[model samples]
Target chain A: MAEDTNSKEYWRWTESNWRDPDIDWKAGEIISVGIDVGSVSSQAVILVDGKLYAYSNMRTGSDSPKSAENAMDWALEGTGMTQDDIHYVVGTGYGRVNVPFAKRAITEIACHARGANFMYGPTIKTVLDMGGQDCKAIRVDQKGKVVAFLMNDKCAAGTGRGMEVFANLLGIHITEVGEMSLRVEEEPPMVSSTCVVFAKSEASGLLREGWPKEKVLAAYCLAMAHRVVDLLERLGVEEDFAITGGIGKNVGVVSRIEKELGIKALKPTLDTQIAGALGGALFARALEQKGRKSK
Target chain B: MKANYGYKDGSGEFFITLDTDRCTACGDCVEACPYGVLEVVDDPVDPLSDVQVAVVTEAERKKIKYTCGPCKPVVDRPPLPCMTACPEDVIAHSW
Candidate 1:
């Protein structure tokens, strides 16, 4: 019984990886991969003949195919690439069928609308995601497919494991909970319980009435951006919009869900938790370009 | 105002709850839902109280734990045809 290592896991979160040093994956002729595995993190990506050559983002441990092969061996670590030079993999979220080196699995709502149409483009047409035990909202279309969606994974009150259990109950450091919930001094009203166990006992009863853990992380990121704007108002927020998971690196719940849906979500120069493993490596490069145009 | 609906991932809690003031848009739990997963609508939580209720079906509200897993029978379990066709008990599943 010896494993305390000075216990400081304030909801961990900080495993990373990247690659693209002007691309060269053995003169790529397709490569493609995309793991995902999500039930609280695990990405992978890698693309090549379709661009973004590497990625990682770790954490989903209790073994989902060894967290999708440790997020594809940390996105092919030194980049001398392996997994047999990958030609097509795919496997999407919620442990996408336990990704045992998937060749196809898909559905993380059509891989977060084709990974928010390749990381916020294709005019986005709304996405949202916010994963780690669920919260979807999709809509897509202009090629990213899924024209309608709205998930919630029932409870953990607005996902990302309810803001990593409210940043390990305010010991704080899940990447400083969005700038310490925007160093609050005024916003405090929400947290009326959307139910992450009753908004974490109403944020420890407002820190026992004295408040301040940045005002209970600004009333629990304004009740998780008003419960993800009531699940993106049941699929009706169209214009552009994009948000992809890992709570879109929480700018206190994406600036209060862009001030309650006045839009403005589309900003991601890559790594908004690798939009479902970059839409499962762009659906494993469109299923290896439809098996080389049906050979 | 017990709305609930479904979702509680990593395999557990598949809510359904209704009791929206004893829901009475009574489509008999949308005809004892055999996976159409109930319907009726309108009461987006008291939209100025016009009252239409029943709910759950926004595409089976995120796959109600696999569309209410075929009447949830594991042994003798027998109360679900949408909570025995809810007559004001206002449905309830929470499995």
Candidate 2:
């Protein structure tokens, strides 16, 4: 079984699931769900009374609704809970409206801000969510309300999809890019082109010229870091910085960003990719509270 | 220089185009936008041009129809606040 699974897999990052094993869902008064269907990945998060309960992250399929449902189902599995148990559902990310079960659709900007605020605490004022197809630099208030934000969906250069292409080209697993690139003794010059197509061709040329794979990866990661920092600077960065999305797990880029901005990112104990869905779940809880009070 | 906002997905395409040449980069559209969708950025589409122009924020680009849904026209309503605020008359929406 293990050999078969390994043989079938491509250069894909491992999908992940996490649950607060100690949390008793039966005792929780509120159960809310947040599903974020991104272009490259989908995440489903379950919250019990404003606390993280469970979450699942998987590659997004072509059909966003199917991806959303599958992610939620994976998260719900073995939890002894079903869709009926969820009191409020907030769908977010690229396919927010496509979430059939979501009671409301929230923008990833607001959701990421709320998630960063919760994960990094009230001091978090800046959130950089680098997702599959876009990068967002959001400034939020102490309570996780959006102050000002900017997003870059116009190009794939600085997004996860770009990184995925590079990973595939380099024949490296997506998860290994960060650590592997760090192994380079000296940082390489950044690839000039921000367009993925041009960058891919540039990488091929570098490989043919005998540049090591690690150096090429470093160059791309540096370019990505610089590009995202430009986005953050455009919106204006503040202290108490934090990053979310799949790229947040990649220290190669994150460290470079921290160095560029001169502010250490507020690290999250849990997986950073779940931040959006987690924020959505938290919003659902807030809505749940309002509903209860109004009733 | 035309910059299109929004993306093509399995469902369909939603785009909001801004002709930068007509825009004066005045803060009118930015201030008039209640949803905070428009911002003035150094024109990225035309690198040779240093002129800053109002364009849809990146996050709102791919989802403007949904993001700006609240202000969408209903039965011959007046122009949108952003469009109305634009002195240059450069904004157009593809619904």
Candidate 3:
């Protein structure tokens, strides 16, 4: 690939597949990008010498490559790092292969497992990634290799997007749904509407039925968590389970998940959302190590 | 209310499109943008998707598709239906 010599713009399209930015690039330090391109949103994580640098959560735009580029551009803006500094690039998620500039591509399942182990530790066996578009339950050995996995990619009923609707109907923030759910005394009315559109109707009906907001909200959280449970069961969840993806940030959901499965789900400080990116960054580190070993 | 994108003219993945013009400025779009990309605005064609009108100038206008992963199915086609069907309406598919 030709080096973009004129790297003097906030962002400039160097080619259809590449862009140049104004940040100075440094070598020797490993820099990589992990991109999780899902049906709902695309994410980019940038790392420098195996340290967290910057991350971007962007809509997957029209194309995975374009979305990856947009996410990469956003991460660069946050980290003040440039493409030239990146020694290795690993892309994950469904669209990892679509990343035009990625040196290698790995499955998001692997990336998530690798990322979780890196942050939490190698002992994590069961992994649950509640992504924007889907929910996945993966059982892996200590090495972060997939041993068993089940995913609800075909449906979006219980993913991060699902909670957003519950938040809107109750006139509460999405972030609050988990906390509020934890507060409910009753199990609240279970939302039977598996369909998102119909769920809104159901939630509105509950409001008309005069159910307490907390109960109704709690039901929603429990209902969504059930989906994860189902996936985990299918994958045969184990102890020291780790959760990832954007929804992992929701304490309400996480706690409910623990209750439903009768097991605690551990989340790293960065938690589920950045699992794929962290996996990408770790891969960058591994690649650099391999290069040195080879030389 | 919902718009979906087809195989991007250049890039390969199907893109989701949002008719910011048709946006009701209702919080639905705001709630729908899970990545927190869309914000309610007092003005259309401009003012309010990224930042509140007060900070509209500082707001980004580059389609900001980065905010919410749009579901633009096709120009006027029923999107993946899952996005439209999901209660969050996070996915916007023009049917």
Candidate 4:
């Protein structure tokens, strides 16, 4: 491959979508919103009468409330729907409690399962949500209620941040890491370090020993895939399995995980990263209906 | 609304106390806890009652400071999952 000079443009994925142009929000009676403020990214989703209307995914800033507001604003940019136009709002993820306008806050684990149920259909029994700084393996019943779950956020070894470090070192865009790593003709030896700090130094040492960047990336991705597999096994893998969060977009990790488990994950037609926020929106809709029934 | 148990060490403070008066032993915390830090056992802290109650697991009793280390939120983050899952308004962490 020829060396590319555009260093600035390649670090992030371009697959993010702001809104679904097909939906006409004016025709719907109820407009519910869900905002997920995660450690690395934030998402805002709008549901019009139980159908997805608009959504936005962006990097989370320092302030949780501000991140929530910015994401929601971006999703509503061209929709002409202000905050007050939405009937109810549900907040989720690590910063859920800090969402200023939310009526209630739900855990990311619950929201991810619910969103996977909607996005992947009700058959999804297991969900692996690989977020920026943490990972969660969740088991959900047919109704999408969380039956069992496990989370690992203390370490960056199997998380998105770990991948970002490799991207930065290789000077390739984070979006390109997956494809570039997959381009290697042969699978390289796995990096032995499980800690992010140690792994970075390990990658540097490999490069010094004349290993190509692609091979190094392949090693790191392989280590990540193995680490996540252990977490999934602890919770017990049940089918139909689906993966959520930004890492779901990486074929390098997803395909390896499937190969190791001998079970393919259910593919989502919509963006997998929005699962948490989408689930929160669905919860908002349900809450509105429940309130009406009680009244 | 909250109960605390444990002690402070050179590394940090570690405590996992349950309010026996408010605990109903619903097992929600046990289900939500990912670290196996909690379990349903006979009420040893509260002798007045015969009901089963949630307590720190024997394995975690001496090592809670290390076991809960991974999920320990910074001062800014939300409450822990197990504490948040409890409907009876009990369960807390000190760190």
Model 3 Cα lDDT, one tens digit per residue, A1-295: 2234543321111121222343234643566677777765677777656666667665565788888888777777744467877777887786878988787776676677778877788889888888877676766677766554444554457776677767766766665677778887667656776666777788898889898888887777777777567546644778888788767878877888898889987747663566886787677667766877899
- Go through the candidates in order and give the C-alpha RMSD of each one to the true structure: 18.1, 9.9, 17.6, 9.6
lDDT of 1 at A187: 90
Better model by TM-score: candidate 1 vs candidate 4: 4
- Can you give the lDDT of residue B90 in candidate 1? 80
**lDDT (Cα atoms) of all candidates against the true structure:** 0.78, 0.82, 0.62, 0.80
lDDT: worst 10-residue window of model 2 chain A: A1-10
lDDT of 1 at A15: 76
Model 4, A176-224: lDDT tens per residue? Answer: 7878889899889888888888889999999999999989988988888
Q: Model 1: residues >4 Å from true position, as ranges?
A: A1-19, A31-46, A49-106, A109-175, A178-208, A214-272, B1-5, B9-12, B15-35, B38-58, B62-94
- TM-score of candidate 3 relative to the true fold: 0.64
Question: Compared with the real two-chain complex, what DockQ does model 4 have?
Answer: 0.06
**How would you encode candidate 1's per-residue C-alpha lDDT over A26-72 as one tens digit per residue?**
98799898898888788888889888888988778898999899889
Off by over 4 Å in 2: A1-11, B1-95
DockQ of each: 0.09, 0.07, 0.02, 0.06
In model 4, the Cα lDDT at residue A5 comes to: 49
How many clashing residue pairs are found in candidate 2? Answer: 3
TM-score of each: 0.35, 0.77, 0.64, 0.77
